[model samples]
Target: MTVTEKDRDILARTLWGEARGEGLAGQIAVAWAIRNRVDDGKLKSWWGEGYSGVCQAPYQFSCWNKNDPNYAYLSGAMAIPFRELAQCRGVADQVTDGRVPDPTGGATHYYAIAMPKAPAWAAKARQTLKLGGHVFFKGVP
Candidate 1:
């Protein structure tokens, strides 16, 4: 897929919102999850068309949700930290260009360990990786 600047920017913002505190490895894992969705032929329609579409798909990434706290910064209502966003941008570029390896082992789903309770879907999902504050999974039913 030809990733547009908007795609890269949204992907970077997603990484910043979702995994900025988790550092480079965590951000990479999150990026791979998005990429997995982008590359999955089975659920192409479900995941939206490409990077931008997938990231902005309704209720997919919470950072894009209108009520989400991160939405303010992601939508430009607030400002993001320059250094952190820059790092996320670098990770986004690498992952989208296929330079970074799939650290989540093809995971298409993940949730932070900080959540009060795991999401219901996680119980039916096969766990693929556990890194930083998030648990990665695949084959979710």
Candidate 2:
């Protein structure tokens, strides 16, 4: 894909909102999952189109949800910490440019392990990789 500056910014904000507390590897893993969705031909109706569309799709990334705790920071209504946002932007740039290998094994979905129950969708998908506090999955119909 032809990633624009808006795409890069959206990806960076997503990384900051979703995986800021995780290590570098964890953030990249999450980014790869989003990239995987962008590459999914079957999901073009909703998930494909561009990084911004995929990341902001309703219910896809909770951090973009208005009620989500990270919404303010992600929407630019609040300031994100410089250090964390910079780290996310660096990783976003590298991964989007193919400077880093995908570590999620082609996963298109993940959820933090801390959730009380795994989502219904994950039950039908194959577990691909686990990084930091999240579990990644692929092969979902």
Candidate 3:
């Protein structure tokens, strides 16, 4: 697969119904799981940072697990890539660095996004932004 920017955009549009901001963020989070997190690599950081920027937190996927409440709430939603609906609802610790079996019998990649901004993170980002923080997000294919 080429996995070009255009491909990402189309995939986002197809999945999310619209095609930018939180909508694109939702799909890109899924793609990030498939592209960078499904395994592990320098590319992982790219997706992690991208997810964090859009959703407004310093999201890191490795920390998510089934034991956590945040993970439980986010799993079903991220698995299907919803819009800003996943935004700012707590530590939305969605994962984008693993795979799960498909109902049809296949393993699919995963990615995560966090919501409601965990206290530590929200505080830190708030402070930084207060001091002038610059944020950026990747464009989908």
The predictions' CA RMSDs to the true structure, in order, are 0.7, 0.8, 14.1
Question: Predictions ranked by TM-score, top down?
Answer: 1, 2, 3
lDDT of 3 by residue, 1-141 (tens): 223343333233222321123343444344443333323344544443233322222343332344544453344434534434333111122223223221211112321223333333332222111101112122221
Ranking 1 against 3 by TM-score, winner: 1
Residue 103, candidate 3: alpha-carbon lDDT: 20
lDDT of 1 by residue, 64-134 (tens): 99999999999988999999899999999999999979989889999999999999999999999999999
Each model's lDDT = 0.94, 0.92, 0.30
Clashing pairs for predicted structure model 1, backbone only: none
Backbone atom clashes (below 3 Å) for every candidate = 0, 0, 18
The C-alpha stretches of model 1 lying farther than 4 A from their native spots are none
TM-score each candidate: 0.97, 0.97, 0.22
Best-fitting candidate, scored by lDDT:
1
lDDT for 118 in candidate 2 is 94
lDDT of 2: 0.92
